[model samples]
Target: MTAVKIIKVLGTSAESWEDAANEAVARANDTIDDIRGVEVEDWTAEVENGAVTEYKATVEVAFPVREGNP
Candidate 1:
Protein backbone atom coordinates (compact mmCIF):
# COMPACT_ATOMS: atom_id res chain seq x y z
CA MET A 1 0.00 0.00 0.00
CA THR A 2 1.08 3.53 -0.71
CA ALA A 3 1.36 5.89 2.19
CA VAL A 4 1.07 9.65 2.30
CA LYS A 5 1.82 12.41 4.76
CA ILE A 6 0.63 15.99 5.16
CA ILE A 7 2.44 18.99 6.53
CA LYS A 8 1.31 22.52 7.24
CA VAL A 9 3.25 25.61 6.20
CA LEU A 10 2.81 29.34 5.97
CA GLY A 11 3.78 31.46 2.97
CA THR A 12 3.84 35.18 2.47
CA SER A 13 3.91 37.45 -0.53
CA ALA A 14 3.82 41.14 -1.18
CA GLU A 15 1.62 40.56 -4.18
CA SER A 16 -1.41 38.29 -4.08
CA TRP A 17 -2.86 35.30 -2.29
CA GLU A 18 -2.16 33.03 -5.23
CA ASP A 19 1.49 33.95 -5.09
CA ALA A 20 1.52 33.18 -1.40
CA ALA A 21 0.11 29.74 -1.99
CA ASN A 22 2.62 29.03 -4.72
CA GLU A 23 5.37 30.20 -2.47
CA ALA A 24 4.35 27.61 0.11
CA VAL A 25 4.75 24.78 -2.35
CA ALA A 26 7.97 26.15 -3.73
CA ARG A 27 9.54 26.52 -0.33
CA ALA A 28 8.44 23.06 0.73
CA ASN A 29 9.97 21.54 -2.36
CA ASP A 30 13.29 22.97 -1.34
CA THR A 31 13.39 20.62 1.65
CA ILE A 32 10.85 17.96 0.67
CA ASP A 33 10.65 15.45 -2.12
CA ASP A 34 7.90 13.69 -4.05
CA ILE A 35 5.43 16.48 -3.52
CA ARG A 36 1.98 15.39 -4.59
CA GLY A 37 -0.33 18.33 -3.98
CA VAL A 38 -1.16 21.34 -1.93
CA GLU A 39 -4.39 22.43 -0.25
CA VAL A 40 -4.87 26.03 0.72
CA GLU A 41 -6.30 26.12 4.24
CA ASP A 42 -6.58 29.78 5.06
CA TRP A 43 -5.65 33.25 3.87
CA THR A 44 -4.90 36.48 5.63
CA ALA A 45 -3.37 39.82 5.00
CA GLU A 46 -1.32 42.44 6.72
CA VAL A 47 -2.66 45.96 6.53
CA GLU A 48 -0.55 49.04 6.56
CA ASN A 49 -2.08 52.49 6.21
CA GLY A 50 -5.36 50.90 5.21
CA ALA A 51 -3.65 49.08 2.40
CA VAL A 52 -2.67 45.45 2.16
CA THR A 53 1.05 45.24 2.72
CA GLU A 54 1.37 41.50 2.46
CA TYR A 55 -0.60 38.38 1.79
CA LYS A 56 -0.34 35.22 3.82
CA ALA A 57 -1.48 31.72 3.07
CA THR A 58 -1.71 28.59 5.12
CA VAL A 59 -1.25 25.47 3.06
CA GLU A 60 -1.25 21.75 3.60
CA VAL A 61 1.38 19.98 1.51
CA ALA A 62 1.18 16.29 0.73
CA PHE A 63 3.96 13.90 -0.17
CA PRO A 64 4.47 10.20 -0.43
CA VAL A 65 5.83 8.44 2.59
CA ARG A 66 8.93 6.34 2.11
CA GLU A 67 8.25 2.77 3.08
CA GLY A 68 10.75 0.26 4.46
CA ASN A 69 13.22 3.07 5.04
CA PRO A 70 13.99 5.33 7.90
Candidate 2:
Protein backbone atom coordinates (compact mmCIF):
# COMPACT_ATOMS: atom_id res chain seq x y z
CA MET A 1 0.00 0.00 0.00
CA THR A 2 0.94 3.65 -0.53
CA ALA A 3 0.31 6.65 1.64
CA VAL A 4 0.76 10.38 1.60
CA LYS A 5 0.80 13.38 3.92
CA ILE A 6 -0.80 16.77 3.68
CA ILE A 7 0.26 20.08 5.18
CA LYS A 8 -0.96 23.63 4.95
CA VAL A 9 1.12 26.66 4.12
CA LEU A 10 0.42 30.29 3.46
CA GLY A 11 2.07 31.88 0.40
CA THR A 12 2.15 35.55 -0.34
CA SER A 13 2.98 37.48 -3.49
CA ALA A 14 2.69 40.98 -4.86
CA GLU A 15 1.88 39.31 -8.17
CA SER A 16 -1.18 37.13 -8.09
CA TRP A 17 -2.96 34.37 -6.22
CA GLU A 18 -1.59 31.72 -8.61
CA ASP A 19 1.90 33.00 -8.03
CA ALA A 20 1.30 32.85 -4.29
CA ALA A 21 0.44 29.18 -4.50
CA ASN A 22 3.45 28.53 -6.67
CA GLU A 23 5.60 30.20 -4.06
CA ALA A 24 4.32 27.86 -1.38
CA VAL A 25 5.03 24.77 -3.46
CA ALA A 26 8.44 26.01 -4.48
CA ARG A 27 9.34 26.61 -0.85
CA ALA A 28 8.11 23.20 0.13
CA ASN A 29 10.22 21.67 -2.65
CA ASP A 30 13.31 23.07 -0.96
CA THR A 31 13.18 20.25 1.62
CA ILE A 32 10.36 17.92 0.71
CA ASP A 33 10.43 15.57 -2.26
CA ASP A 34 7.96 13.60 -4.32
CA ILE A 35 5.38 16.34 -4.17
CA ARG A 36 2.16 14.79 -5.37
CA GLY A 37 -0.31 17.63 -5.59
CA VAL A 38 -1.51 21.00 -4.39
CA GLU A 39 -4.90 22.24 -3.34
CA VAL A 40 -5.80 25.87 -2.85
CA GLU A 41 -7.70 25.87 0.40
CA ASP A 42 -8.38 29.56 0.60
CA TRP A 43 -7.64 32.95 -0.90
CA THR A 44 -6.91 36.33 0.64
CA ALA A 45 -5.24 39.63 -0.06
CA GLU A 46 -3.82 42.73 1.49
CA VAL A 47 -5.06 46.14 0.44
CA GLU A 48 -3.53 49.56 0.76
CA ASN A 49 -4.86 52.90 -0.35
CA GLY A 50 -7.81 51.14 -1.99
CA ALA A 51 -5.44 49.06 -4.07
CA VAL A 52 -4.47 45.45 -3.64
CA THR A 53 -0.94 45.31 -2.35
CA GLU A 54 -0.49 41.58 -2.00
CA TYR A 55 -2.14 38.29 -2.76
CA LYS A 56 -2.28 35.39 -0.34
CA ALA A 57 -2.99 31.74 -0.93
CA THR A 58 -3.60 29.06 1.63
CA VAL A 59 -2.50 25.80 0.04
CA GLU A 60 -2.42 22.18 1.05
CA VAL A 61 0.68 20.37 -0.14
CA ALA A 62 0.86 16.62 -0.47
CA PHE A 63 3.70 14.16 -0.69
CA PRO A 64 4.19 10.44 -0.45
CA VAL A 65 4.92 8.65 2.82
CA ARG A 66 8.05 6.68 2.58
CA GLU A 67 8.35 3.18 3.88
CA GLY A 68 9.42 2.82 7.53
CA ASN A 69 8.86 6.59 7.92
CA PRO A 70 5.93 8.92 8.15
Candidate 3:
Protein backbone atom coordinates (compact mmCIF):
# COMPACT_ATOMS: atom_id res chain seq x y z
CA MET A 1 0.00 0.00 0.00
CA THR A 2 1.02 3.57 -0.66
CA ALA A 3 0.07 6.91 0.72
CA VAL A 4 -0.71 9.94 -1.39
CA LYS A 5 -1.29 13.61 -0.85
CA ILE A 6 -2.78 16.36 -2.91
CA ILE A 7 -2.06 20.06 -3.12
CA LYS A 8 -3.50 22.94 -5.08
CA VAL A 9 -1.44 25.34 -7.10
CA LEU A 10 -2.05 28.27 -9.37
CA GLY A 11 0.04 28.89 -12.46
CA THR A 12 0.05 31.54 -15.15
CA SER A 13 1.41 31.86 -18.63
CA ALA A 14 1.32 34.13 -21.64
CA GLU A 15 0.72 31.18 -23.95
CA SER A 16 -1.87 28.56 -23.01
CA TRP A 17 -3.39 26.58 -20.22
CA GLU A 18 -1.12 23.65 -20.94
CA ASP A 19 1.91 25.78 -20.34
CA ALA A 20 0.42 27.09 -17.18
CA ALA A 21 -0.15 23.59 -15.89
CA ASN A 22 3.37 22.63 -16.78
CA GLU A 23 4.70 25.66 -15.01
CA ALA A 24 2.84 24.78 -11.85
CA VAL A 25 4.18 21.26 -11.91
CA ALA A 26 7.70 22.45 -12.60
CA ARG A 27 7.60 24.87 -9.73
CA ALA A 28 6.19 22.25 -7.45
CA ASN A 29 8.98 19.92 -8.47
CA ASP A 30 11.53 22.41 -7.26
CA THR A 31 10.59 21.54 -3.70
CA ILE A 32 8.64 18.35 -4.13
CA ASP A 33 9.50 14.91 -5.36
CA ASP A 34 7.77 11.70 -6.45
CA ILE A 35 5.21 13.42 -8.60
CA ARG A 36 2.32 11.18 -9.38
CA GLY A 37 -0.36 13.16 -11.17
CA VAL A 38 -1.92 16.53 -11.81
CA GLU A 39 -5.49 17.66 -12.27
CA VAL A 40 -6.41 20.91 -13.95
CA GLU A 41 -9.18 22.25 -11.78
CA ASP A 42 -9.89 25.60 -13.40
CA TRP A 43 -8.88 27.90 -16.23
CA THR A 44 -8.95 31.64 -16.63
CA ALA A 45 -7.43 34.50 -18.54
CA GLU A 46 -6.23 37.99 -17.80
CA VAL A 47 -7.65 40.74 -19.95
CA GLU A 48 -5.96 44.00 -20.75
CA ASN A 49 -7.90 46.69 -22.56
CA GLY A 50 -10.43 44.18 -23.93
CA ALA A 51 -7.75 41.79 -25.12
CA VAL A 52 -6.67 38.53 -23.57
CA THR A 53 -3.19 39.10 -22.22
CA GLU A 54 -2.44 35.93 -20.29
CA TYR A 55 -3.69 32.49 -19.52
CA LYS A 56 -3.95 31.02 -16.05
CA ALA A 57 -4.64 27.62 -14.57
CA THR A 58 -5.55 26.16 -11.24
CA VAL A 59 -4.25 22.66 -10.68
CA GLU A 60 -4.27 19.86 -8.15
CA VAL A 61 -1.00 18.03 -7.84
CA ALA A 62 -0.55 14.59 -6.35
CA PHE A 63 2.45 12.65 -5.22
CA PRO A 64 3.36 9.77 -2.97
CA VAL A 65 3.82 10.61 0.67
CA ARG A 66 7.29 10.26 2.03
CA GLU A 67 8.05 9.26 5.54
CA GLY A 68 10.49 10.50 8.18
CA ASN A 69 12.09 13.26 6.16
CA PRO A 70 10.32 16.31 7.41
The TM-score leader among the candidates is 1
By lDDT, who's the top model here? 1
TM-score pick, better of 2 and 3? 2
Candidate 3 deviant stretches above 4 angstroms: none
Q: Write the per-residue lDDT of candidate 3 for residues 18-68, one digit (tens) a residue.
A: 999899999999988888999999999999999878999999999998878
List candidate 2 segments past 4 Å from native.
none
Q: Which pairs clash (backbone N, Cα, C closer than 3 Å) in model 2?
A: none
In the range 1-70, model 1's lDDT, one tens digit per residue, is 7799999999999999999999999999999999998899999999999999999999999999997877
Q: How close to the true structure is residue 47 of candidate 3, measured as C-alpha lDDT?
A: 96
Sorted on TM-score, best first, the list reads: 1, 2, 3
lDDT of 2 by residue, 1-70 (tens): 7799999989999999999999999999898899999999999999999999999999999999888756
On the 0 to 100 scale, the lDDT of residue 54 in model 1 is 97
Give the higher-TM-score candidate: 1 or 3.
Answer: 1
Clashing pairs in 1: none
TM-score, structure 1 vs. true: 0.93
